[model samples]
Target: MFHIVFVEPRIPPNTGNAIRLSAATGADLHLVEPLGFSMTDAQLRRAGLDYHDLASVTVHPGLDALWQALLPARVFAFTASATTSYADIAYRRGDVLVFGPEPTGLDARVLEHPDVTDRLRIPMLPGRRSLNLANSAAIAAYEAWRQLDFAAP
Candidate 1:
C-alpha cells in the first residue's frame, strides 16, 4: 500500500473525509502534528467517517518522527506552487504522497527539506489558490493507483 501523509492538517472534516478515502483505498494515513482540531470532535465523526476509518490513521508527533517511521520511502509533496504535475511521478509501493494543511499549505522548511523526493501540483487555472484538500488527495491517490493498475485488481 502507498502512504498518505497530511502535514499539520487543520480542519477536522477534511481530515475525516481523507480518513475515509484512505481506508477505502487501503493507503496508510499519517497525520503530522500539531493538528488544528481533535480527531475525536463530533464534526469529524459527522463527516461520514466511522470508527473503522481510524484503523488506517496513524498520528505522528512531528515531521521528524514521521520521517523516522517512513524513512527510505520517496515522498512526493503536493503543493500549488510546484511546476511538476503529480502525474509525472512514478509512484511505487512504500512511496509517500503528502498533502499540506488547508489554511496555509506546507511549511517552507518542510517543503524544501532535502529528503523530499519531489514536489508536485495538480494543474489548475491561473490565480486559483487550490483545490479542496480532500479532493486533491483523492485525485492524487487515484492517479497513483491507476499507475499501479489499481494494484492487480
Candidate 2:
C-alpha cells in the first residue's frame, strides 16, 4: 500500500471519498490541515465512514508535521507544471503520493522541496486546468496498485 497525502484540502466530500478509497485500496490517507471543514474524528465517522475507513485517515496539523511522519520515503508532488507524466514513474509501495488543494495545485515551495524525489502530473487535454482532487488521487492510486499487482494481505 501507498500513502496518499492531501495538502490543505478544502472540500468535504473529496476527503470523505478519499477515506473510502483508502479503505478499499489499503493506502493510508494523510491530510495536512488547516482544513476547510471541521474534521473531528467523530465527525469523520459520522460522514458515513466506518471505524475501519476512519482508521485509514490521519490528519496532520501542517506540512512540517506531515514530513515528520512520512519522511525517508520517496515523495512525489503532483502539479500541472510538472514535465513528468504520472504514468512514467515506476511507483512502489511506501512511496508517498502528494496532492495539493482543490483550487490551486501544489505550491512552488512544495514542488521544490528537497524531500520530493520528483514532481508528477496526470495528463489532460489541451486547455484543462486540472481534475477533481479525489479523482486525481484515485487515478494515481489505481495505477500504482496496478503496478504492484494489487497486492493485499
Candidate 3:
C-alpha cells in the first residue's frame, strides 16, 4: 500500500475526502499537525460519511515525528513548484506520497527534507494554480495503484 501524507492540512472537508480515498484505495493516510480542525469536526464527518472505520488514518504531532515514522521509504513531496511531473515516477509499493496544506503548499523546509526522494507536480493549464487537495491526493494514489496493477490477489 502507498502512504499519503498531508502536512499541516487546513481544511476539514479535504481531509475527510482523503479519508474516503484512503479507504477506497487501501492507502494509509498520515496527517502532520497543527490541523486546522478537529478529527471529529462535523464537516469532516459529513465528507467522510461511513468510511471512517475503513480508512487507515494516523496523525503525527509534527514533521519530525512523521519523518521518524516513515523514514527509509521513498517520499515524494507534491508541490506546484516542482518541475518533475507526478506521473513520471515509477512508484513502488509502500512509497510515501506527501502533500501540503490547502492555502499554501509545502514549506521549503519540508520540500528540502532529506527524506524526500523528489518533488512532484500534477500538470495543469498554463496559468492555473492547483487542483483541490483531496483531488490531487486521489489522483496520486490511484496512479500509484494503477502502476501496481491494483495489487489484487
Q: Which of the numbered candidates is closest to the native, going by highest TM-score?
A: 3
**Residue-wise lDDT of candidate 1 within 2-51, one digit each (tens)?**
98889998888888888887767878889999998987877777773564
Please give the RMSD to the true structure for each candidate, in Å.
Answer: 1.6, 2.1, 1.0
Cα TM-score of candidate 2: 0.91
Q: What lDDT score goes with residue 24 in model 3?
A: 92
Per-residue lDDT tens digits of candidate 2, residues 1-153?
799999999887788778878888889999998888867545544543674433477889999999999988999999989999999999888999999998997898788899999999999998999999989999999999999999981
> Could you estimate the TM-score for every candidate?
0.94, 0.91, 0.98
Collision count for each candidate, in order: 0, 0, 0
* Candidate number that wins on lDDT, 1 or 2: 2
Worst 10 residues of 1 by lDDT: 46-55
Candidates' C-alpha lDDT:
0.85, 0.87, 0.94
Over the stretch 15-75, how does candidate 3's per-residue lDDT look in tens digits? 9999999999999999999999999999999999999999999999999999899888999
Clashing pairs in 2: none
Could you tell me the C-alpha RMSD of candidate 3 in Å?
A: 1.0
Residue 142 local lDDT, model 2: 94
TM-score of model number 1? 0.94
